[model samples]
Target: MAATGVSANRLELLQIADAVAREKNIEKEIVIEAIEEAIQKGAKSRYGAHHDIRAKIDPKTGELALTRHVTVVEDDWRPEDELEEFNDSALVRLKDASKRDPEAFVGKEYIEELPPFEFGRVQTQMARQVVMGKVREAERERQYEEFKDRVGEIVNGTVKRVEYGNVIVDLGRGEGIMRRDQSIPREIFNIGDRIRTYIYDVRPEAKGPQVMLSRAHPGFMAKLFAQEVPEVYDGVIEIRAAARDAGSRAKMAVLSNDSSIDPVGACVGMRGSRVQAVVAELQGEKIDIIQWNNDEPTFIVNALAPAEVSKVVLDEEADRVEVVVPDEQLSLAIGRRGQNVRLASQLTGWQIDIITESQDSERRQKEFAERTQLFQDALDVDEVIAQLLVTEGFATVEDLAYVEAYEISDIEGFDEETAEELQARARDFLDRQAAEQDAKRKELGVEDGVLEVPGVTLPMAVALGEGGVKTVEDLADLATDEVRGGFEVRNGERVRVPGVLESFNLSQEDAEMLILQARVAAGWIDASELPQPEPEEAYEEGFEGEDYMAEAEQLFEGSSDAGAEAADDASDASGEEADDASAEDR
Candidate 1:
């Protein structure tokens, strides 16, 4: 018998290593190394702990060897710091080495063979623990390496056990965990049930690999369709985006590489069999397969299927889309609790605001009237000219002020001379407005430093001063939302007072950026704490000019004030004259 109570043939050692490696799904070399370590530990127990002993097994022959080694040192040798790493007993002085071998020289190594020990219960138990520990560590490493790359891939497994609402699965080679939240809504799995899931994550822990599986992830739905649909699997069709409510509803956008193949039809399968298979696996979750379109408006319309979209107005600066559907289709477009539009937004990566046709028409009319009034007042133009300018997509006084002369001249009934005059008037109006606001800010005793903050316009500084935020420190002390929408008591309820940001129709992101800038300006926060600005091209179109006043003009142009109100009369008078002219022509 072997020293550790194993068979003496030594071939048994190799056989055992092979069996353990196969069972643990680890490398044969790892198992062999574990065995060598166990033998070395056993040798240490038999030999004195201070002696330098080594054990090795022949990889091919399975022959085990144990030897005690000593390094020959010169007679005048003194212990150096580097020599301290070696065991003192392992260093044999030259005088002492002469007894063993007169030919022994410094730096030479001498080895003595050690006789194998008889089997001992304590030694056998210790060796067993060491081998088992090493085997477990090796197995963990193997499991991590095997599953790490499998993330985002679909895997099938059997539910081994249910522990506190979590399902432990046997994946043939290793174990995986499908946490309760990772499962589809209201889905329950019993022990021994076969399941398919997405390998969303794989984490290596001290105990073993944590293979996190999910059926509720949107990628899981996409992967499931890939498994059931041949077109998707063969790469003829590619899923572009997917969003899921898990066990309730899901939407997948797919595009076909081959124009002859309809991606939606292929995903739906022969008589809906392919899509049904995925739905069945997801516990009867309803799925909508939409054809992908490169055109953003077309894609958004497709994403909001089963609901007719009459119009889609994209606001690129806000990353939002205003979707108008027929009055009859409003409920369907919004779905129950807005799920339809929500899923569409997720699929298209755009925030969607669904409205009925009537609502959209009314909003457009209001915007037209507002812009017409703004142009009539700011440019001192007649209602005909204001309406024509608004029709040409000039929404703000700043648009008329900063636009190239060609943009205005290109409008009907306007030429180079008229366009130049309009632009000059627009600039003069803005200068007067700025001078008035500066006078008001000074009257309110607001510090000039507050005006230097990135997003703080003259009107905003005046508003802040009136609100008791006269200094940059005061502005920095405000919460982001408070700065965006002022805090006030309204109708016995505390509410936002529609602050400068709200008045200017600025987004919450813009408001937050202004607050961060204020904090940096006040020295309350380091400049590095502020987020980096986007590249020049990424800034809102038409607002990315070198002139800072262009942004301020855009912000304050639409504000309802005495000047804007006076402009309304000009628009009304001009409208009457145009109506008279139209009647005469008819």
Candidate 2:
């Protein structure tokens, strides 16, 4: 830092290092090391570039020293960068050093003290750059260490400047940039204005560590509530899930561990004071404080506030829920631009499909009619008989075919002979259908061994064959995402791509089991290598959603919680294994 050609002074250099260390918020030792390096660079320029020039600064006396070092290295040792040869000036071979001193070791260094020299024009500029570069690096490291763990925390800062549409905030210890997309829509701020933001992510970059700040993140609202609601801060109440249509509306599900305290009222406060405080900070984003229910349907209903729900049907296999609302409550249930349903979906962790009662009824009737017609054609039964079978809850001809004779005979106005005749016809139709499918499957070049894979049905084989998978090996090579369906980037946008078995509505585990079984059948793996199935109880304990249902194989056998846990665990394992196996196999 001293100017070129200036006389070296002890106290001035230490004082300069102390001031720079304090200003940069770095350790004084680091500044001293940076100064030593700068002096070394200057000395190297003055002497020869080939010499190993070294410099050191005393922490207390600020005494400066310069020296040259020649290290003794083994003759056969080569540097990591093979392109560069060892320098004889800086490095001496052990063979040669041993000759100079009988007991010389490989690591022994020969040091020679040099006379002090003044910095030149080029040396001064080089020293300044070296010092600045090291100091800046230390400062960046300090900032990263200070702020990396502060993510997900709300911070108060002043608007330092704006670049394009992003705002740069001075956070006292470091700087944070709230990108345009992370800021609340329509919110405005000027230089020197105080603002609040949530630290969402911190990433180390070449320029510096990036502290990504956001006001629109749901965590920001949750933190604001924590500040305003003591119950939340004290953990008496827990915010289970939160979703935001940011700057427009948000939904937060809160639960009280204490049975006496209502979570919704606590968050809403007396006369809405608590919720209002949070809303103000969020740039007038509407907040809905809802009670969290372990039951997913109830929670989803609560999340779609001001909209009444008539019914909810959850497809555990799909992680989707079809909600039936009253005809008049359609708009309210869906919200503007489907916001209500979207937020409810996010809060419940279910894909929400909203429909009106009329639509649901129409769909039910259409399904009933389709089933009725299927029986009429397949069983050669009259419309009245098919309608009677449909009314009795026979959804498929297979149900009638396999069902006990008593089940059909017990139907009003049905005789034992009639039930038996109906079953025989149903069986014949299924046999003919299977025969047809087998013929078509053969035509498509599907191997019969594919049918031996666990869980592969006739229709599944047909579908697989149509999908260009003709053998067991082909089935084993599929990824779970390919089987359960996944997205594809098409023309710069993500589009849904259906899997071969997508229409089967198979759960992720079912797909994996299918593939794993196929792998065994194809001799790609051994059956003994398959994971032992865990009991359904394994997942039931820590299940998060309220709408846990029994395993699809079991008809409402266990509680919903128990069922979902098993499904999720299987799905996760299957998904991971499928990805790995397919990556290798393909």
Candidate 3:
């Protein structure tokens, strides 16, 4: 540890190791090892770099030893390191060594102890840098191990400094960063000021471990409630979900396992004392504590409190909900800048659209008229007959084409002959539509093999042809995002691009299935590789959670025929729109 020549007593060496280990909060053995490595570097600089010089220090006695080892090796021995060609000082050929000692063979080592020497200025500086680097590395590792597992826990710290509006806090044992975006809006922190934050993430970076702290995280609010509410902390009441427009408004859903206890009332606390404490810490943010329910409709209704909802229509496949509210409550339901509805969407895990009753009525009527017109034109039926079919729940010509004769005949005023005539017309119309789609698909260069793939219809084949996917291999090489549609960033704004199958409203599973089947038909993968249904118990235990569509796309893209290369060059830039929420900024 000293720049002077080894003038210090042996006891001083042990003391230096113990002091450094204590100061850095590392193991004494690590500090001793660091010193040993520093000595090795210094020795290498003094002796030839090609010489195999090693240094070792005694832990109990602090006795240091330096030695040089020259090993006898095969005449053609070559270093495994590509950067190294040969070293004559550290290695000697067996034939050459045998001239001095007949017993000398490959792997035989001759060790020589070196006398103590004075430390030069350059070697001293190099040793100091090496020692400091190792110690600093150990300190960073210790800090990471201490904090990585503490994620999701609330911690209190004092602001150490601010960089670019981000607050760096001194957390007693480690440093944490509260990113500018992760802090509550308008909340300022001065150096030395105390702050409470949630440990959302801890990453070991190249420079050091970064503890990502957040004051505006939903988990922060949830943790605050646990500290204030005894029932929540004790597990009697569970905070099922939480969403926040940090420092402005928030919503939390609570569920009570006990029938006798009210989750909302308990969270509200006696005379709002518990809730008030949390709000004070959050800079006066308003919180809506709603009762959580198992039924999704009931849950959505509860999530949009203070607004009277007339009806809720849930689209399970799309994870969207259409909520109809009274005209007067529309403003209240949407809140200022759509905050209320956004929080509700986040809380319920659904995309919510709040519309007034009048709007819903108008949309229903428009849809009904469109369906009626479609039946009239496709079946060549009169308005009266089309209206009857629409009222009977027949929305498309395909519906009449596929329905059993008895079902259509059972409709009031529709006998077997009428049903038969309607079905005959529906079938004839579909046949002509299929033929037209097939002609277009062929003209677009889509192969007949594409239509033969499982789950692919003629209309889908035509859509694929338009999107630049022609052959079975081309279809198999499509990512689920490309087929299901996804959003793309353009000119700094997100824009939705429709996928080839976007109009078909295919679910994620269905889109993946289409690509998987196509891959099988294209000979890229075996049909036996397709996933099969498993029992619920077994599925839960081993849900490989594999993405067959993505795997197939990766396996075949850029590795297929010239047709696939052309398809890739001509692929559509559009994709499905991704789901999003406004309160996501929080």
Best model number under TM-score: 2
lDDT by candidate, in order shown = 0.83, 0.88, 0.88
Writing each residue's lDDT as its tens digit, candidate 1 over 482-558 gives 76665677789987565644566667788788888999998888998877755332223333223323443344466
Residue ranges of candidate 1 with Cα displaced over 4 Å:
1-9, 46-48, 71-86, 91-107, 118-122, 365-429, 440-586
The Cα RMSD in angstroms, rounded to one decimal, for candidate 1 relative to the true structure is 11.1
Ranking by TM-score: 2, 3, 1
Q: For residues 1-586, could you state the per-residue lDDT of candidate 2 as single tens digits?
A: 6564324778888898999988988999999999899998888888888899999888999888788999999889898999987888899999999888888888999999998888877888898999999999998898999999999899999999999989999999889999999999999989999999999999999999999999989999999999999999999999999999889999999999999999999999999999998988887898888999998889888988889999989998778899999999999999998898889889889999999999999999999999999999999989999999999889998999999999999999999999999999999999999999999999999999998888999999999999999998899999998888999999999999989999998887788888999999988898899987555454444332322323332533466775565566656655666688789868
Q: Please, what is the TM-score per model? A: 0.68, 0.88, 0.81
Candidate 3 per-residue lDDT, tens place, 1-586, comes to 6565554577787898999998888999988888888888888889878889888889999888889999999988878996987788999998899999999989999999997776788988888898899999998999999999999999999999999999999998878999999999999889999999999999999899999999899999999999999999999999999999999999999999889999999999899999999999999999999999999999999999989899999999889999999999999999999999999999999999989999998998998899999998898989988998888788888888998899899988889999999999999999999999989999999999998999999989989999999999999999988998989999999998788899889999999999999999989899999987563333223322233223334444576674354334223211111112234423
Residue pair clashes in candidate 3: 485-575, 485-576, 486-575, 486-576
TM-score of 1: 0.68
lDDT accuracy of residue 346 in candidate 2: 90
- In candidate 3 the C-alpha lDDT for residue 215 amounts to 88
**Between candidates 1 and 2, which one is better according to TM-score?**
2
